[model samples]
Target: MNNLPEDCIAKILSLTTPRDVCRLSAVSRIFSSAADSDDVWNHFLPSEFPAGFAAPEGLPTRKRLFFSLVDNPLLLLHDPPHLVSF
Candidate 1:
């Protein structure tokens, strides 16, 4: 299982819940990296979640944002799904 491609693992994990992803992260280093990826969390986030949420463009930051939104969903409701400019 550890030998599987990171992105492939992420894709499989994406089909599972956040709890499952976190649990699997403890299985190995590869799992840890893939479990924390943006691709996996994007599946759990609201369908409208903007990819640009990674404004700081860091791996950890993107994971943190995912958890923040999960822990406090109101933020999703508070902002427009996408920002607009004139």
Candidate 2:
């Protein structure tokens, strides 16, 4: 790892899948920020579901539902209706 250049490391990390990135982030400080960068996030969002894969109606599960909601203003409205106090 010491021999790896920073750019090459970034590129390699960038190509890593999100789950791996999340796991790596816990390994060190530098890795945590690198994994959370806009470059990584931007790459992640679009790659999560391939082009033309539409969100299923009503989203059958919470993970799917959250992904669809994260970038949507309309779904923000749904949160108020489903709020559960801890």
Model 2 scores what on Cα lDDT? 0.54
Off by over 4 Å in 2: 2-8, 47-86
lDDT of 1: 0.75
Q: lDDT per prediction?
A: 0.75, 0.54
Tens-place lDDT digits, model 1, residues 1-86: 98889999999999999899999999999999998888898788777666666443343555676775555554444355643322
Measured against the true structure, the TM-scores of the candidates, in listed sequence, are: 0.73, 0.45
| lDDT score at residue 61, model 2, on the 0-100 scale | 39
Give the alpha carbon lDDT tens digit for every residue of 1-86 in model 2.
63565455556777887678778778766776566565555555533333333446886433344455565523212333332222
Candidate 1 segments exceeding 4 Å error: 54-60, 75-86
Report how far off residue 69 is in candidate 1 (Å).
1.6
